[model samples]
Target: MLASQFSSRHPSTVALDTGLSLMRVAAPIIAILLVQDLFSREFDRKLHLTSLTYPRPRYQFLLGRITAIATLLLFLLIILASLLAVLTTWISYGYTQATPPDLGLPYVITVVFIALDLLVVLAIGTFIAVTSTTPSFVLIGTIGFTLVARSYSGIVALLTRDSTLVGNADTYQSSLSLLGYLLPDLAALDVRMISLYGDWQFLPDDWPLRVVSTLAYAAALFALSVWALNRKKFS
Candidate 1:
């Protein structure tokens, strides 16, 4: 009862969104602020490594820095995610002429998936930032991830599917299903089609597969990011 009630709460950026807003805003946090402090900041023209070796209040300094960076990013991302979600909702609604269609469940689901996807993005950015010791590398990696995911999504689908179904079938269901399954599968996670026009739910048997695939993708990406961070030798 309690869980359902909480779930029923009005749609907001923090709740359903996979935290894309935070991830989007997090670039400045990692690059501008955190990187400057951790990699660039120096007392007197000395290397940051100097402080690392001769640390004073090392633990407190690091903790405060991380907290400040994360907090700044969190709200920024929340706003961004919320704005995009609302924009998508408004656009779809205008096209469909359905106000709060399907009790706004599709909107709800889309927001949630976007937020979850951002969690993976954040993990990648944070890990890269810490491991590379330079925010430039991390920012580049994050942008690359986004571009690859968005661009390849359509190409992969076209190459995988038979010509007959390519035009009408679900984008992910075409030749792209393999890569779609491998990466975030933003196509599947995106419920925009439903918002625009109804009759879009996946079958019961395949629904579980979708859930498993998404969970696996998120876990795999997050684990890879953590692995990269763990191997980093802060020197």
Candidate 2:
């Protein structure tokens, strides 16, 4: 399928490409669908009041739920990586008589990026769930925001290019600068090229910055969701 498109002469590339293929198509969708009802269901069924009456603070409860989801996803990702490892070995044998492929630090870092991306999506989904009154609205908002966040940079790039051709680059470039600061550039975190080329030069060297930015963005969303939940009245 889509994974075959990323297949390369290198076993490492095959493993990484397969993993990215799965993540590209499935990660955000799975993360959103999993967390879309996190808080909305509570509001819909009138369970938020009961949950708020617990001994712990509100943020702690939210953190617990988020942590639980993250842990579950971690387990699933581990299984996925392990399967890819086995597949890489099989592919390696077919391509070369070398020993089982040894995935290097790059693959490890790529896995971290994939996990972080999922967490970012989860945080956005949680925020939508917390703010929305109905599960349907939560699902819609989460999907909408995910699509916007993922493509915002590309959309701005297109606008800036068009504006330049029209001799009005300043207007669009300024707006694009403002938007670049406001929205998380999820594209910056894409390391699929590294997996495809099996080399560091294939991807941006400053990828760590992207990972840090995403972490900060996810933290902000979690804080906002907690704040919103605290301000809300269960009645």
Candidate 3:
């Protein structure tokens, strides 16, 4: 429907971009809900007590829950990506844009990056779920983290372009730069232009490093969650 309504000649590109943009927003919410159900709700209802009674160690339970949620998320991503690909292909039929989208490798890579982004969010939510006593904090913290991580780079870039537009722009930029170390700049993971324009130049020079850093960050969070769960004493 979005493809048919797109005013641009490249309705296929617009359609895929719009669909992906929607997925970017929706995926985090879905991941947070899964984390809440698998981890937060278990703690909230004291269901973990029964599950922990199993001979398996606490880390095993934590690992298994995270794995289950991640698998479900991956499956959903694959289905959505396939549907979007079909829609884009259908829209592109007959009409040819000056710059056709790759729709093949580039599209697959874009989807994989999105999956990584969701994994990072899931890991953060899982960590918050295990450490925070209040189950609600898991949702709040995860959403807050997502908002900050996704937008901070853009905010800093805007400030950098015109310091005179905002008073004390240096202060804001400096603060954001410092905070950047702790938060993954998820916006950087969005290499959709590579797929949208069918241009490898759209891929960032540091994209491989960014991917590694994202994976490392998620792994570290998962490890912390496991540690937190092991140390948590239930009353």
Candidate 4:
């Protein structure tokens, strides 16, 4: 169900395009190099040259290889994010929008939140992949969840704006307003807005609420996902 939206698109998983320029460009090259040299050399040199490998043993080796790659990926994400943050700071130094790296405790919080988000996503993908016995299901589900979240955010923001949402002081209007306030409003934490905009375009005041909200929501989602995975029994 989660992946339905992703599969709906023809040629689904052409994810050959999404990501930061440096990562999007460098990742595949790096992966190929690593796999060809390290993975292939280790496995092929050991198995084909060393001995015959069985399916179970092959999966074990592949799983170990994936763990190493995932670790590398985590570090890659950290470095990439740190580089972007540094570059943004360097470019925007002395500008009005320049907030210190420690500004309002958002950096650490965001990093932790994003890490947790990544774990939840990977967990969801792994669980679904294992249970469904189809890699596409996991791929599509993760992509679909992201797409659905984006769509839901857009509609909620459009409907809750002052003109449409808080139009009148009627009871129903107040309730609608309160509901908007309570629902997980994600548009607030859009970090891209800060990175793309010129310095001084926005203040901490403009985005702090979003950071807090996203962190809170991320925690809840992660907890729920973990609980679900723990309870799920695969046949």
Each model's lDDT: 0.49, 0.72, 0.90, 0.43
Model 3 regions more than 4 Å off: none
Q: Write the per-residue lDDT of candidate 3 for residues 123-233, one digit (tens) a residue.
A: 999999999988789899999999999999989999989898778999979998886899999999999999999999999999989999999999999999989888999
On lDDT, the leading prediction is 3
Per TM-score, the best of the predicted structures is: 3
Candidate closer to the true structure by TM-score (higher is better), 3 or 4: 3
Ranking of candidates on TM-score, top first: 3, 2, 1, 4
Cand. 2 TM to true fold: 0.81
Q: Give the TM-score of candidate 1.
A: 0.52
Model 1 — which ten-residue stretch has the worst lDDT? 1-10
lDDT tens digits, residue span 1-235, model 1 = 1111233332322222333334434544443444345433432234545655654644444445545655665565556655655654443332333233332565555455555455555545554555554446665776676556656766655655555655655554554555554456544545544433333553233655666766676566546644654454554
RMSD of each: 9.8, 3.6, 1.1, 12.8
True-structure lDDT of candidate 1 = 0.49
Candidate with the larger lDDT of 1 and 3: 3
CA RMSD (A), model 3? 1.1
Candidate 4, 39-137: lDDT as tens digits: 334433444333223444434443455467557757976786666555544433433332223322344444443444443344334334333434344
Clashes per candidate (backbone, < 3 Å): 10, 0, 0, 2
Better of 2 and 3 by lDDT: 3
